[model samples]
Target: MKYSYEFYRDHLEMLRIKLPGEIELFADFIEDISIEQKADEYITKVENVLNGLYQDFEIQLNATSVLIKKDMTVLEHFYTYEEPYENEMETEEFKELMLIWKSKIPERFKKKEN
Candidate 1:
């Protein structure tokens, strides 16, 4: 499956207020997937959240899909604002998307190697 996303000013502003620094963390997670081989733990985190084992965060990732449920309170407020937005992609497509997103991250937000 192919995935696409558009972020409006309001959406970004809301995210900045509601989930500060999450973008950086997300970038780190993307890098970790490649550098640290965290796919298993990433899948476990997704599974745990989906199974109600934990509520550590709103975003979840598994082998096949990426789900982002930022806020359910105002579902469908915007055409782009789908409650619990999910993208199911083949492995290659998903990896491509991750790299694309990783590339878009601002230089200051990228993780520094020791």
Candidate 2:
């Protein structure tokens, strides 16, 4: 479940502009995973999104796997064939990747000190 992520500066910049409101939540998700008590809370949020209890974000749970994308439509091709994303990673690996990406965000986008 290890992932090889490409650190794209432009993608980070794009998220900074497009998902300004989600930045804090994303950061908190990363932080919550590191804390014992809060980890379940973070997982619950993700599960809510995956299970359709929440629909505010772009995330999909197909069978036992999860997909996070900007556009759920992009998953059509994969769904038709019941395929996992080419870039699929385990949850822990995904958390690690998020941490790396979070570190690259410019200081201005961060609402609180890490």
Cα TM-score per model: 0.28, 0.29
True-vs-predicted CA distance for residue 89, candidate 2, Å: 1.6
lDDT of 2 by residue, 11-55 (tens): 333323111221212322232233334444434544555566776
- lDDT scores for all predictions? 0.35, 0.36
The runs of at least 3 residues in candidate 1 whose Cα sits more than 4 Å from the true structure, single-residue gaps closed, are: 5-28, 35-37, 58-114
Which tens-of-lDDT digit does each residue in 20-113 have in candidate 1?
A: 2212223223433442235545445545554567643343333212342221111111122433332232334434444554444444233444
Q: All candidates: CA RMSD in angstroms?
A: 11.9, 11.8
Give the top-scoring candidate (lDDT). 2
